[model samples]
Target chain A: MNSSFRVTALLLCMGPLVSVLAEPVPDLTATLKAAFTDKRQATLDRLDQDETQKLCTQLRDQVPTSELSQKITRMNLATVKPPADGKYLGDWKAGEVVASTGTGLQSSDDPAKPNGGNCYACHELAPTEMAYGTLGPSLKHYGKLRGQDPAVLAYAWSMVYNSNSYAPCSNMPRFGHRGILTEQQMKDVMAYLFDAASPVNQ
Target chain B: MSVQDRYISLVAACTLLGASLSLPAEQTSEEAIAEYHAMFGDENPAELWQLRGEELWKTPRGSRQVSLEACDLGKGPGVIAGAYAELPRWFEDTGKVQDLESRLVTCMTNLQGLPESEVLAVKFGDGEQKSELEAITAYVAAASRGSRITIPLDHAAEKAAYALGESVFFYRAGPHDFACATCHSESGKRIRLQTLPQLTTSEGAQAAYTRWPAYRVSQGELRTMEWRLQDCLRQQRLPQLTYGSDVAIGLTMYLARNANGGEMAAPSIKR
Candidate 1:
């Protein structure tokens, strides 16, 4: 048999094995899109990535590129809209309820009802409340420490409004950016952190 | 001499009290959590579901009016021992890697002649929809209590499932851009007081996987693995995961395989 013919037979024998090995791996984006479905309040559109989301995913929560981080922060900051009335504080008593209630954005939850900030799920607000989470820093004396300074008030409002504006990949949710909370809800939570008589200060 | 003796006795008593006072007032979280588990050992609320399952296993009440006596769980027909430990295996008949719930649903329709839609309709147990599947799953898992986890990954499909699961675990996309790995891949990370298991590690995977199909104190129900996975996805703010889907089984395969050699400890009680 000719050398060229022998080589041709060898290639034919390896074709199936090579093809099997070369089969493209399933794309993560495509797999997730296929696996999840729109049910109740959770729509299929959620699977679609925004620019900020894409960057955060690519970096895996680490701020890898300074230029990208600045761009992300700038883009997210532009999305934050301050209260029209220039009010950053609301009834702290009402705020406590908003902070404590941990039900919102879930498919099982009723869509008609307003969303909750669920701050207590990640922060210690009241010094007396024995049961509190440690995912975020303790705000036990936030009001006493900051003392209603205008700049401090604005900073807190901005943080709660859209945390990503400051920290590109912060674990804190963009309550206002994602429409997770209303302006009144954000102001109320602000009062909970800034009211002198609030249990968080006491 | 009497005064000196009394004074010395008083000093000794004070020292003893001081030493005792220096000891911790309460148990550490780890110790307390361990004690919580130990308190419910072999007599957890999960046992009640297991009993109900055993009764259902023998009783015949389906569309075909037959029990699941002829069903095969990787093991031979009607065999319950050590069957769950080797689950999420590739079933030749189904030509798919099925987890416990998926395999159970298959048996319900194929062997008992029940409609797949009917079985899937009431997957979770609620006020008026008490899940028979949950009870059956608890019973099957309890049977393999001490058996070592040995999820098979020999087949090409099984390998594919594991790969898909691994990708799903780390695949970050959503409003929050959080993946399963975001909360689970790190050690000593937590949401609140509740501890998050680092599933990428063998120890974490083993600890977390062995405790599933557990009786949740908060829910007051015996939740199957499928229920647990669905809730996790919900908290992630992602769209609802279709129950008994390939992705769900794939994630299970990845976690179960990572937990190889760990003893099965399902039907456990969890806070």
Candidate 2:
């Protein structure tokens, strides 16, 4: 198991049960198949599930043994790669654009064009941006609150790269791990989070 | 803005002043709701997002000078359908955990070769840039509609994230002292005509969580579930949440787990 998984296994072993079983379970997979018909710029192949996904599906959110959770977490953690230049911070202004862009990864995109982060979909970052969402946590003081500890920076990096690495079923996109953000973009986003000048700290 | 209210007020004022103040009455709330639906129709704009997402999946652009057909959606590169259902899972090739959006970005940058910074520069939910993400998300969600949400939360990091997410959900802030739970933890609350679902309850949370990437009639755009949650915070008079923050995902995980078995109704229409 990767280090992350080992740590998760240890942590979950000590934590309370986290699962919340869904009731009145519909024939979810079948419903998915039936509801989604292959169309232009959309397709049916996305309906399939992987092995780990199946297990997670079966368990819903009640995580099984802590060790197993760690195994999974660590395995994913191994995937993160720091920037080529070894810098984790970027221009938060540019990062704001990355955070805002919610494009790419679909049939609608030129495919030749780049993708956006759609960060506002879940995060509350800057104070001035009136239109925002709350599905995620408010990051208004991300930098000011978290401080620039190496652990904090790394953790943030990992969270942006692959939130699932830290939370198996996390809803946030793995900006770096998933390749949604470039090293520079990741740095820019990092700046948006850590830089005192960024609005997130205002 | 009710037609009947306008008519009544006009009639009363005219009667008081003894002047004819005849005008087209405004629509009733029910009529207005119906008008909204009629204006909205069954066809969600999100469908357009799904359509465009598919195009982006194949067409060649970006610095890589290659089409995304070779990129994997967890099924394998170029695999479109059903890939999203199993996401937030670990991938060894990249050696990192990824969600649908992040993975798609990987494909776009690696295979397409768009400057990651340029692509990341776009805004969320508006402008030309946000539209791309919406279309792609709609398409991806459409790809996995009906599939179970199975995010592996076993990683130590994943576990930590859950801890973080759980903590974040209970966190309250803003001038009015708001938390996600403030409106969602309890059942059956609303601002005006809008019924707020109780997210603390499994049944209500699932209902709220499952029906996202929804077409918003009010905004005239297709928004993902993420947008739904973030917008709620904004309405609560809180700070603007940046795109893709950890606490957001943690909170989302909390909600997702609660809504696990709800059939995916993504790309659904909303008011």
Candidate 3:
């Protein structure tokens, strides 16, 4: 058992009923499967845990061994496809719209509508937006600070494409790998971060 | 105007803006927000739901045309005051550890002679359909206002539920590799402007658990604990949690037990 599990076991053993601690926690995966059903865009397939997901579950987002972390990062990086036409920038105005919208994949949402980047949900993209979330760092002066270098552009593209590539088990969703955002939408968002005229730079 | 005059005016404007921006001594942004919240606490629209709930509890309805006054909430039949503070307890009659909503459904079915399927089908209130469940939950939760939360763990089942809940809270899955702990395990974190409560610790859990079953001003609906769990999972990209499922009950037991000494403030208002 891991140190955390051992600690929990010890705590449970200290309780009045020793027998209860020995009664092994029942299998929950089966129970979870039985409890959930398909509805709208959310299907039973969403419950299927892959290798990376299973490992993350075991680690609880705690930084795992260097080897395992590297493996997860490598695995996710492979899924990120560079823009098809080698164009890494799109309309900043369109990007702004995508970043602000928060609806898409939810079952209650309209499936026919295109997905939103929802960037403001976790990041400060513009200095004027006072109500931005702080879970992710403020990118208010992103382009102004980073400059319009090719390497910097590529780095930003990959970060949004598959955040786990850089920080394994990151809270940021894999917008590209998960198909949450289209290539065109991602390009527009890149422009919003890189374009000199964009409010993000201002 | 002369350049010197413009510069002096600019400096004065800058100084004024800086003073206005500066926070008062020893007060955190959270504290400032708390004071702001306190200012509007009395105007909470949740009172309307409670009034409706009180009326429903006494009125006769359902197939049997009987009021829910006879329902035994594990505190004996019709004993409601202070009962919510010690809930998700082992119910001897049902032989299952049930949360308030589950128990209410049981009572509604058994005591009031309503069909379980029918009650379960009418999940949430949308428009004028008006969920009876929401009204009843508001009434029951309000009854325990000021009473300390003291969820019992005497039963073996209750203990197991707590353990399972702790496990589930940390359990990660779905497309984004999100768990409840991913956002909430740490203190002083926010996803956007919404501050995520650290549920692993007593201070955080107590603060969060007490204020749920809140009237969401945005939704214009009163949301229950069960709805909170389901919605959290939905955002996690997991399939919807079955209403009043064992998973939801287990999670409730874990949170409620942690909030042992916290005063009940449910049917609270939320943005």
After superposition, which runs of candidate 3 have C-alpha atoms over 4 Å from their true positions?
A1-27, B1-41, B60-65
Model 3 per-residue lDDT tens digits across residues B1-271: 6544543453344334334324222333454335436654455556666777888889887889999898988788899998888898998888999988999899888888888888787677764677878878888998899999986588889988887777677777766667888887766777656778877667788889998788664455778898888888888778878888888887898788877788998877655
**Higher-ranked by lDDT: 2 or 3:** 3
Candidate 2, residues A64-121: lDDT per residue as tens digits?
Answer: 4567667667876888887777778889899888877755554344546666776765
Q: After superposition on all CA atoms, how large is the RMSD of candidate 2?
A: 18.9
DockQ of each: 0.23, 0.02, 0.30
Local accuracy by lDDT, each model = 0.76, 0.60, 0.78
User: Model 2, B1-271: lDDT tens per residue?
Assistant: 5544543443343233222111112322234336445643554456556767788766888866777789787787667676665655556777665556666667777778877676556535563346566677788888777877665666655555455445445443332223555456544444223456766565786677667777654455678655665566554333444444554555566666666556776776555
Interface RMSD of structure candidate 3 (Å): 5.8
**What is the DockQ score, from 0 to 1, of model 2?**
0.02
Docking outcome class, model 2: incorrect
Query: Which pairs clash in the backbone of model 3?
Result: A133-B192
DockQ score, prediction 3: 0.30
lDDT of 1 by residue, B100-140 (tens): 89999989988888888888887888645778899899999
* Residue B183 accuracy (lDDT) in model 2: 53
